[model samples]
Target: MEGHKLGRAPNFTGACIVMFGVNLGWILLLLFAVYGLVAAIFLGLVVNHWVSWLEHRKQLADQRYGDVSGDT
Candidate 1:
């Protein structure tokens, strides 16, 4: 412990900066991945709505009553 200079090893400042950069990159990458996932979910919902509307319209075209069911 006498001559070790063991507080943060060697090149502490440079190593810290490098670690910070790596962590920042990882954070940005993770945020992008999450954004892509959310976007995908929203796109799926939009596609589902579009398909439902298209099918309803098709049914209306097939019959004059506009795709009505017996329940309501």
Candidate 2:
């Protein structure tokens, strides 16, 4: 019997490169998403604390001035 040459192996380098790029893109996107979420949470907390502080100041002012009707 004569030896025969088999078909060349499939070239997967291009596919691998594309998959790598896609994976990197997804990883970066997820990182930014998490950062945005954390930033939003911190911003909300800061805003809430500021508003509460202002309200507390107003209450103290009212108590000091005896303005219970909230007109002042």
- By TM-score, the best candidate is 2
TM-score of each: 0.40, 0.46
Return the TM-score for candidate 1, rounded to 2 decimals. 0.40
Single out the weakest 10-residue window by summed lDDT for candidate 1.
63-72
lDDT of 1 by residue, 1-72 (tens): 778675754647788879976975675567568786676566556766987999888777768865455433
Q: Write the per-residue lDDT of candidate 2 for residues 23-68, one digit (tens) a residue.
A: 7567556756878767656655676698799999988988898887
Q: In order, how many clashes per candidate? A: 0, 0
Clashing residue pairs for model 1: none
Query: CA shift at 70, candidate 2, in angstroms?
Result: 4.6
Off by over 4 Å in 2: 1-35, 68-72
Against the true structure, what is every candidate's RMSD? 23.9, 26.9
In candidate 2 the C-alpha lDDT for residue 53 amounts to 100
CA-lDDT, candidates in order? 0.69, 0.75
